[model samples]
Target: MAAVLSVYLDLALGLVVTFLLLSLLVSGINEAVVRLLSIRSKFLWAYLRDTMDGAGPHGSWLPTRVVDVFRTMPFLRDPRPAHEARPAPASAGEVPETGTGASMINLLYERVREIDHGKQGRTSIAEIPPARFAVAVMELAAANGDVEGLLARLKQMGSPLYGHLKGVWESAQGDLDRFRKGVESWFDGEMERLSMLYKRYAKWVLAVLGVAVTLLFSMDGLEYAKTLLRDDAFRASVTAVAGSGQGAYDELKARCTGAGDPVTCVTETLSEPALVKLMGQALVSVSLPADGEPEVRWNGGAWWDRVSTPSHWPGFVLTSVALLFGAPFWWDVLRRIAGLRSRR
Candidate 1:
């Protein structure tokens, strides 16, 4: 019984170890796949943002439209001189002091319209011909391709257009830099946040799967124990102990008593098909008899007495230990097989 139990115990232990290994393998494979796919922080953030912000092809444009409005029309402008200039004449409810490059462009277009109207009327300003002045200014601005130098030249010419142009240019440069830095920082932060979230999600999924596998194996182990306890040979062995009070030895002695030499009698009893079958069955069962079953006993001075030793208690303990450790490993092996098949 001990030998049989030792074998079963070995099997169970192997199975538990196999299960642990399989779990590790599954987790490693999942992580490797994720890494290989490059499904990291940046990708997660972009996916989430596009999904939530409705910027993708199938998405609504409402959020983006609102954001565009806010970006184009900030509530406050910088108090610096660059942002406090304008070319457009002050109108009702208009701040006369503050204008931007966009305002200057608007002013230029308005002036051109006025010149064209005057020319049609045959009363064009000859000293500062509008077309010539516009062309010359455009050429000068393009010559150096330096926006600040062009604004300075315009300022020397002392037009509201100069101040407006300079203010708009300077403000745009600072605002552009600030906006760029803010976008970069936000992108970086979002990536980090998404990376951590994914890691936690993966960890939780792995943990849950591991626990589920363990529970399944535990149930299997319990079923195995039940099967072992219910074997026919096990039932018969237990009954023999209760009836004869000496288990297999008592039965053997009773059968051997009148069969000539004591050694021959013992051998003949052991060789009986039924007894051999019982021993074989006992070896496999390995479970203890149910509670209240009689203890095994043998003749006071016989070798059989030494062999009985109360009951098959040791076998039961060893078997239990083997199964306790082996079930998880066996479950793991089964899981690995399943995983391999799935991959295929």
Candidate 2:
């Protein structure tokens, strides 16, 4: 029983470590994709437009004006006047401050055009504090901090937003500060929901990326596992690395948590030459096949057929599915297995 348990623990540890490494690689790639596309900023922009749209009986003119204020938010604007600011496109035309509905709609069009052509970093703001967001909206809705005017305008718009603000205003007993706080709290709730929505999107990204990585590396999880179970030396080496206490996952986690932005931290950390060299050396030490040998090889028959052959399909699917569990999950499993093995 004791010998059987030891073998099982070694197998579990080896599998967990393999999954963990693959997950880290995929995660780094995923983070790069998310950052490159600026998905967070896109969602934020869409949410603000929809929230301000009001969908009232009023024409698009009113909603357009409200949405235009979004670009002027302090967070979105660059303070540097001398940074060679690009002029808004000529086609957009100059919007006159006529205070007429027609002029307001035109101004909204201008804002949209500018945003579409805006310099990348200047237009993409992924985060906005709840308080600042609430304050900006309140200022836009109410001219000169006039509560009555704000209420009148919102009510005139006939949107659900008006009712939402009215409830907050009443709860504050007409105190401007309290009303601002209420709005901020509401923004927080909306952001929480937005976060969940983003997570769902991220899961889809992970699934696609997982399949891509499995294909690129020709990673065969089942074949690798079978090899590890049968080869005493390979299994021992892999298990020893898992039991080393200090691991790539733990180190990456620590460095990323300390940085201002986790995504950027990960990108930089994984790009370090020393870290990459170390990882490469470790893999080589265990005689881990660098380009998918002993299972799938590059030179065998047609390249596509080599990977797509039915025997390799199960391994490919298993590897991709394991990746969806993510690095952190496998890291925890590795740690627990190592701890159990140590106890005996």
Candidate 3:
């Protein structure tokens, strides 16, 4: 009974390792792609456009500077001519006269300008409290436009990002405190969305790698299971090795976990293949072919012959899904079974 249990357990562990190895390879590849593609910068740029300054270069203004009081400071603007130092800058409203929304830096700049009360230009989104943003919106409502009308105008002006926040403002019903809280919550939600997107990317990477690894190894989980059940000698041999803990298992574990980069793992470990070659090399007692049977090379059968076989598809699928459980899962199960064997 113990040997039989170990047979099933050993097969499960092997499949799990295959999946885990593939998953690691995918992660390593993802890191490489991220490094080479610099995709995060694109996402950052998109996020900035979608949520931040929607009135910059690709925004409402052209690449050249605007001459209005809202003109951006080009790192080195004339020293106010010394003879003609004008009121710093002003927006087109009864609001404070420091800076306006015309040629702002980013969404942060626009947000800060709307909220500045002292005309001091000291407050900014980076440091100013969330309360100030609320104050600015209230000021806009009081002097320039009503909140609802302003939002409607923004939507019309391609500021669709703000449109999503319409409900928060509406529910606030002109209550500054509640509206401020809602704005904070909305920002939090966007951050959470970004996190989820990264996680989703990782999952996709793992899935693609899993498929590749399973095919490369030609490991059919269902077929492996079937083999263990039907062949008593092979099954007993595998159970003995698994229960005692194979040295190759440790080597695989160490190589996989120790390799800093997954590319190296592929070159060093997977280069020789797993199930097809490693089985014979690592286990003396686990050869599938009878001593007299011919040992065929390179997966033995031709492409269509193996793929078209009805028995092949299900096992391949089972192996793929088993990988989704990940390496940690199989490792844990294998350890628990080993412990049971030690006690018995």
Candidate numbers sorted by lDDT from highest down: 2, 3, 1
lDDT digits (tens) for residues 217-267 of candidate 3: 555666655544444443343445468757435444444686788556635
Deviation from native of the Cα of residue 279 in model 1, angstroms:
28
Model 1 alpha-carbon miss at residue 262, Å: 24
- Best-performing candidate as measured by lDDT: 2
Error in Å for residue 324 of model 3:
3.6
Model 1 over residues 98-177: C-alpha lDDT tens digits? Answer: 32322232222332333332221222221223233344334444543545555664555444445444544555574534
Instruction: Name the best candidate (by TM-score).
Output: 2
Candidate 3 segments exceeding 4 Å error: 39-156, 173-177, 193-205, 222-312, 326-344
Alpha-carbon runs more than 4 Å astray in model 2: 1-3, 54-122, 141-145, 155-160, 233-303, 340-344
Better of 1 and 2 by TM-score: 2
Better of 2 and 3 by TM-score: 2
TM-score, prediction 2: 0.61
- The C-alpha stretches of model 1 lying farther than 4 A from their native spots are 1-22, 35-42, 45-53, 57-181, 200-344
RMSD of 1: 26.0
